[model samples]
Target: MRNNGSDVLLTAIAPIVWGSTYIVTTQFLPDFSPISVAMLRALPAGLLLLLIVRQLPRGIWWLRTFVLGALNISIFLSMLFVAAYRLPGGVAGTVAAVQPLFAVFLARLLLSSPIRPLSIVAALVGIAGVALLVLTPRAALDPIGIAAGLAGAASMAVGNILTRKWQPPVSLLTFTAWQLTAGGVLLVPVVLAFAPHLPAPTAVNLAGLAWLGLIGAALTYVLWFRGIAKLDSSVVSPLLFISPLTAVILGWTFLGQTLSPIQLAGVGFVIGSIWLSQRPAR
Candidate 1:
């Protein structure tokens, strides 16, 4: 069993790595369709992990793996891409930001995690912070996009809860591999149906894909699933704040983005919210 501090840190690494996706997508992968990019990232990573672990799901594990894969990866990612395409980046981000709260609700209902008043307040504050931090004044709401974004959040939240509910019989490595493969395979038809013509691949594109697959998806997810197994869903949930926080930092450092006063305050609020959510119930 991992120590609490180590589990927290390991769980954190997943979102931090995910936060770099914006930079990687912008800098390394340009002009690629979102679905195609997702397919590349997921399928290759899943295959790579399968090769390394060499364990296939058996009996009921197959169904559970596919369900987890669809919820966590295929369906969640599909809706996310839809929201990103239909809505402004800021609007989509704000909508997706409510995921931690959803996780909290699911945890309380399903995992029986204590529903602390402070955690609820923290989630609300975190949502407000994300809105201020990411939502621009000109951002307009598209109902379909908004729905997709919320659904995406809910999908992941439920996935997190279900993962906790269903313990894996195999090692985390093999279990993680199974979900990734199942999810990636499920996404294949979606990619074929929606995005048939992929962009021409370059050396840089391949390199970026490799980085996203190997490091971002494979390794980070291993850490993430293990954390889910060991930690409370609510505890693991709030750590997602690290993703946007890291994104804000990357934007400032690498892209010369500046934070407004409101955004700076939002950052503080988000940090505080994450801290509050992780605290033991009083």
Candidate 2:
């Protein structure tokens, strides 16, 4: 088993890479088709990973992968995008930040991990920090969007809990491919039904797709599941705070955005909560 420190660091990379997605979407990707972008990110990355791994899942794992893929990729992405379209990004993001809390609950119910008080408190603190960091004064809540966001978080939380509970029998790469391919395959109809069409294959579009597929989906997920297999779900979940924090840093560095005093405090809360959550359990 990997040490906690190494596992934490490895898990951290997934969210940090995820943080870059916002800027990449805005600056590089073609406009206005979230479904296509999601589909392209998942499917191609999955195919590449499958090719690299060159292993198929065993019988029960086939079913498990389908279930996991649906929750983690297809449903989560679909609901997340629906929420994003209907609500302010901040609102949707804040709702999504509740995922760690959901993971806490699911971990308790599914994995039989005793609930830690500190972990719960840390999750709340992290959610508040995400809110302060992303929620705008002008933000308004739409019921549909709120529901979608909560649903997305719930789906992802269950997926994480299940992943921790059911350590795959295959190698990490093969396991990753299983989930990705299943999810990607499930997304086909959704993409066909919803997306107007695939984004034009311009140079920038291709680059954007490549980055999202290769780095964001394939590589990042491999790192994520490795952490999941090695660490508790709660331990892996709190690292998600890194996503927003990384996004803030990236925006400040690249987009010339400045953080307000409140936002800086939010950053502190996020970092502190991560530390508190990861501390040795009493």
Candidate 3:
């Protein structure tokens, strides 16, 4: 029970780290194109991790690496950056908060896990909370951003399902490194073709890049896979709700973004939903 508690706590930390991503991206990264920023985030970190692990994928795992890498890192981050660029930060985050809902459905379909009605309810409530917090009548709703966010969510859902389905023989660190490297390699052509001009890199930008590479990508993924290995996907995925809520708080406090009453209520709903979702079902 104590170990379970610790694992949950560790699992919780991954989202908290992720929640800061928006604030960091907005404040620190150069106003480069989203794909450029995404590539920068993935490539160096992936190389660093690969160097440390120094393990090559064998047999069918090579395909698994590419597929999971695309779903988890390359496609998900690219879509997320598109959403972030096109929509309000809060709205983009709200869309991302629906990840657990997608995860639940995917797990049921892919892993043959039974979906508890309570899990669905919790996901809906959490998503409602996100909507309340992020949506506004005055905000310009971009179809592209909406699609990007939903696509990002779905991509991540597929990646999580794949993680459950394919257990690599490598250590958690090695597996994560391989996936990141693969994802980064996939981004090169896209970056060259679309984002030809790189933004002027600053010390702050460098610092932000380092943080995302080391803490966000490498360490966070290590914790994520560790939790997935130990816990049910149904149990592990919903904990992601903490991310957007944390992002909201960070945005309010650090970014000087004011939260409307509706947003506050949404935050409350997200918090409550996460709490409910994390509870062990009867």
Candidate 4:
């Protein structure tokens, strides 16, 4: 029971940590390029963790690591950065929050998890809430940003399913280290090819990068995997619904962004959906 309590606490915190990424990226990181930021976040943190772990995965685990790395870290973060850059933070965040829906659908198809009716309804409600929050006439409607956010969510969903399917023998830290390393390696060429010249890193940017690499990617994954290991996906995944709300609040507080009445209503819907999704089936 104590272990369960710890897992729940950790799971709840992971998304809140992730929610800060938007503010960090927009305010701190250099305006060099999204891919560059993504690479830096992954590479250094990956190397640090790998050095600490020092035990490499073997056999089929290598392939699994690569696939998970691509889906979870590389593709997901890269596209998320792009969406954040192109779209309003609220829009990007709200779109990314659709991850729960994607996760539910993929879990059904891949993990053979039961797709409860309430889960589907909750997902749709959440989606509608996000749409209300983000769709504004003043904000530039970039199809590319929308596409990137959805793709990132899809990648995350696939990665979540894969994490369940391919349970590595290593500790959560070790597994996360390998995945980060693989993702960083995959991103290197892309970053080099696209963003060879980086912007001068300011103190603020460096601080943001450090927080992102260390806390957001590294510590968050450690906690996330630990929670997933201890809890059922049904219990663990819905906790992610808190992420966008955190983003919204953070955006409002730190970034001085204001939420419209409709957007506030949207947030209520999202919270309601998340709560509903977490309840045990009747």
lDDT of 2 by residue, 213-275 (tens): 899889999999998888877788899888777777787888887788988889999998898
- The lDDT for every candidate, in the order shown, is 0.81, 0.82, 0.85, 0.83
**Any runs in candidate 4 off by more than 4 Å, and if so which?**
1-5
Worst lDDT 10-window in candidate 4: 1-10
Candidate 3 residue-wise lDDT, 219-272, digit = tens: 999899888888877778878888878877887898787888888898789878
How would you encode candidate 4's per-residue C-alpha lDDT over 31-133 as one tens digit per residue? Answer: 8588998888888998999999998889999899999999989999899899888887778877787788787878888888888888888888887887777
Q: TM-scores of the models, in the given order?
A: 0.92, 0.93, 0.95, 0.93
In candidate 3, how many Å is residue 189 off? 0.9
Better TM-score candidate (1, 2): 2
Rank by TM-score, highest first: 3, 4, 2, 1
Error of 3 at 256 (Å): 1.9
Angstrom error at residue 153, model 4: 0.7
Sorted on lDDT, best first, the list reads: 3, 4, 2, 1
Residue 2's lDDT in candidate 1 = 25
- Pairs clashing within candidate 2: none
Model 2 regions lying over 4 Å from their true place = 1-3, 30-32, 83-91, 139-145
Best by TM-score: 3
Clashing pairs in 3: none
lDDT of 3 at 248: 79
